[model samples]
Target chain A: MKLKNEQEQKVKAGRYGKNFGGQYVPETLMTELEKVNKVFNELKDDAAFKAELHELLNNYANRPSLLYYAKNMTEDLGGAKIYLKREDLNHTGAHKINNVIGQVLLAKHLGKKRLICETGAGQHGVATATIATLMGMECEVFMGEEDTKRQRLNVYRMNLLGAKVKAVTTGSRVLKDAVNAALQDWASRSEDTFYVMGSAVGPAPFPEMVKHFQSVISKESKKQLQEQAGRLPDMVVACVGGGSNAIGSFAAYIQDPTVKLVGVEAAGKGVQTDKTAATIERGTVGIFHGMKSMFMQNEDGQINPVYSISAGLDYPGVGPEHAALAECNRAQYVGITDDEAVAAFDYIAKEEGIVAAIESCHAVAYVQKIAPTMAKDQIIICTLSGRGDKDVASIAKYKGVQIDE
Target chain B: MSNLAQIFKNQKVFIPFIVADDPDFETTVKNITALAKGGADIVELGIPFSDPVADGAVIQQADLRAFEAGVTTQTVFEIVAAARKETDVPLVFLTYLNIVFKYGYARFLKKCQQLGVSGLVIPDLPYENRDEIVPLAAKYDVDIIPLITPTSGQRIQKIAKAASGFIYVVSSVGITGERDSFFAGLSNLVAEIKEYTDVPTAIGFGIHTAQQAAEMAKIADGVIIGSAIVDIVAKEKTNAPQALEKYTQEICTALRTKVEQ
Candidate 1:
């Protein structure tokens, strides 16, 4: 049963790589997760599934979102030709809708009537609620109690979309705790419920499935960029929370080493301080939220309480695939401080008249940092993963500006 | 490993669980002794982790209390080392994979051997994901107890075939907590597991009362009462030793009555 060196090398590479992504969930959820994997494999290549999914994305969530040429910013930076992949234009105003629509279709095909998910900034919560309403399935979302307060507008949106929001109040009461609540709920009711992981950081089929669905970002941009710009961009940038958007935006270009991929993480105050969410920068190899990924934890393996001004980018771990990519240097990951992201947030909205989500602002901040040093002809595409309206109140609060409640 | 197997011989079994250092380290040591004095066949100690996705509210709160008490892996081991002085009760650490993976596997397992801790019951480390550490666990003579839920289906054979010391048969398809009723045809699945492995199967999850324990032990070799016991600890706090002793004795007396029949 032993293999040759080539096969051995392939064997050494795990589901994501040698060190990430597996089914480390409870045995109670094993059969359900396995069924999801089987169903995904069957439907991924099915022409009918693809056609249905494409139709929904086009007519419902707004597919082929405009890849805008940021002419003003390009001239302002005077370094790289800037392009913004406008995932912000999608229904629910975030790239989260792409994966939501895809997963809801899968849940429908599997004859599941209940949908459960976890959200941080509530983008995923709103997206899941929107899609579940369209599909006429029951939707329940878990959000950190603090996040529910921070993004009350998103909570109301989810509620109006017919999804019940559960405010989680354990273990730092943030995105990770929301994930904990959702997983426990799924473990209790997997027979009739489908757990839609918002990020590409969980165990096996989830990371792969979320990536497969969100890959539409890069799939459309690659073709659109070729027709519009007549050449591939030198770099593609996206923010990494649990890395769904980053992986999706990088999916098409990962194989082409010429097109560099970058994932920007929130550094909170600074990586040197105890208040950073820069997992890839200051994390050890550990397992949590079911995947073996780079996580901020102590020597005793306790998950650290991560902090960020942007609720969307505040998690202790990066996606498993991102960890593997970082390990092999296939993609570059950098951290942005709160001040930098806020500056980018205001600048992008004013300069391009495009309000970018604070999560996506992390990537914008990074692009701003390096764009000035690059050749003007060199192009870089940054994915605006969500519209910034939900973050407007928070940004105002962060800046000590008075806002009416 | 043999010590764990010895507990199932010629009689039905009772395994009581509690979060180590739930209120404090002293209570944990006293609680283990109480369980042993109350006829516990084995004791399952929960090492608190920040995220315990497979545990229900009662046990989750217990973990929070333990963390508030500043429990660490070293503190849990110190509790275990202290308890070993009072009783020879077969002890196992029920924890998440990160707890062990974060602590070097070799070092963790070696420490388990040194402490006479016989097994592990990691809810997250399912059959497919435990390949790398199985041999290392065996090298330390520590049992990596396999879990088979109602949803395990055909995976039961694959898991049970290689399982040793014991098999944890989850009575329902959910996290660890009490339920009004378990899933139907559990005895059939227990029968299926029996066809594949010789290891004793203990039905847990939802078996809270002595009545439930007696009924579940009829189908499997033993019963595991967790959240209910932790609930007692949560309610009684430092005086959990008294409550746990009475509770363990009730379950044991119920199991013994079933054996006599």
Candidate 2:
């Protein structure tokens, strides 16, 4: 199959286009977003800003995370060699810190005094809180009431990091609602607050900016895989909630047609079931949260309340870039059910001794299925976007085991 | 001329916004008629969206109440159509972009045109990116009203030039809600908007009480009060029409006082 050049595809998919993305935001927010976009554009070229960000990523965030060859799983799959990009080892235990660190630095440079963000499973919340505490900025996190209950430990962790966590009870009481609450908060306080969007979603600059910050994952993995595996991987896999980690992992390799980009989505029960977060797999083009992306919405354009075993992957919409990627057929998206993800989580724990986040397990689940179909020499690199510590309680409860924390 | 044009031509306009089917569709129709009878020059009817990022808690709750009451885009259009039979008050829809896009932009605007709905205030569709819906709106002769905020700065002129019906001047740098005071530079913002076009400019966002409405009327062609009226609807529930009418009359009275002065 012929593939459109990644750069050409990006040009065609301008900030907001018919099928992909656009800034569908209120006029009041345009000025604030534009101001952030201005500084962000300058910081992209400013040597000092670049150096500071690099130094911070290297020293503080502990970059150059390992590319561990999962030999046991590779042997078990009996088809392709599997490599795990250990974003789980990053500071704050997830890939979320990469974007958070970049955004927090940008916020400080822009003279923003307060930081606000929304999170689903609390990884982004924890990362933002960690960076905000480090920067001595006032930080607030909006979390859905349902997510707060599921990710209680991370909520406490955020509080311990000196960030106030506000429980949002509106709408579906999930990532989308938290995002709405955070946007509302930003709308009211945009003058003094920097809304550090958690995912590669939202309007212009945000999808681009978050992807840029996260591209570091792919950049590092590309070099590391060349050294570790002696060649670029055949497939790059990551889970897609709002698609930050997947986009981050796929960013560098999108231009390389040889490398197959695979995105895994949560198919709660099944794509046919009402409960699913498989946006790219089962969604139509629509506008929500300031971006025209593929969303699991009703015919009336109202976003559906999606379900997933992993709170982090329980969003109805995917990032605009992911939508564009899917549209251009540069990448393939697959849905993995909750049972499949949980089984993969357990299998990876036993076979690889790595307790993966339930979100990442979706990707791992797809890898297990697809790796068995590929040749032994072919390599698959999956991003373990975060550690599983935050999900242990929920996983335990899923198995009907009570943990008294 | 559109009802909006005629409404803005004569005197200071008092535009009141309410989420259609907040308590119920019948109550919405009654409240809209009440608003018209209470001296509203233009009635801004909101189509409840599941996510309203530009609205604060008050309007958000109103949206939720409407949703729980089983309001849909079709229901809102029907309510407006029903109200049109009873009153000639210019009706404008205040909703998010997704609502219209999902309803099919052409079809939605056509329905608005067919029903005598004069304008649309889609907060999410900024001037730079309105091409998707603007031409269709023009075809339907439904004014796609533009909004200018204090932060708009130089963009005000560009927005004001293309603006139709009336320019909604956001009083402060925030979402809709009652505020004790507006941005200190609001007067200058209004003055800047006037520099480009003669389109009637109305100030909204954070205008609650009659006093605030009266104060805003001093600087612009009109005043829009949303959350305050929604708050009344939220509080009074099924018995909201009387209170909404009374509150609408009070603010209208104040706005007219400014006009008379």
Residue-level lDDT tens digits of model 2 in B1-261: 255766777788999999999989889999999998888889999998888888888999998888898888888888988888889888899988988998899999899999998899999998878898898899899999999988787678789998888999999877888899889998888888888888899999988888888889989999999998999899898898888888888988888876797
lDDT of 2 by residue, A309-390 (tens): 8999999999998887787778899999999999999999999999989999999999999999999999999999999999
In candidate 1, what are the lDDT values of residues B159-215, reduced to their tens digit? 999897899999887788888899898999999998887799998887888888999
| Model 2 pairs whose backbones collide | A16-A21, A16-A22
lDDT minimum window of 10 residues, candidate 1 chain B? B1-10
lDDT values, one for every candidate: 0.90, 0.90
Candidate 2, residue B237: lDDT:
89
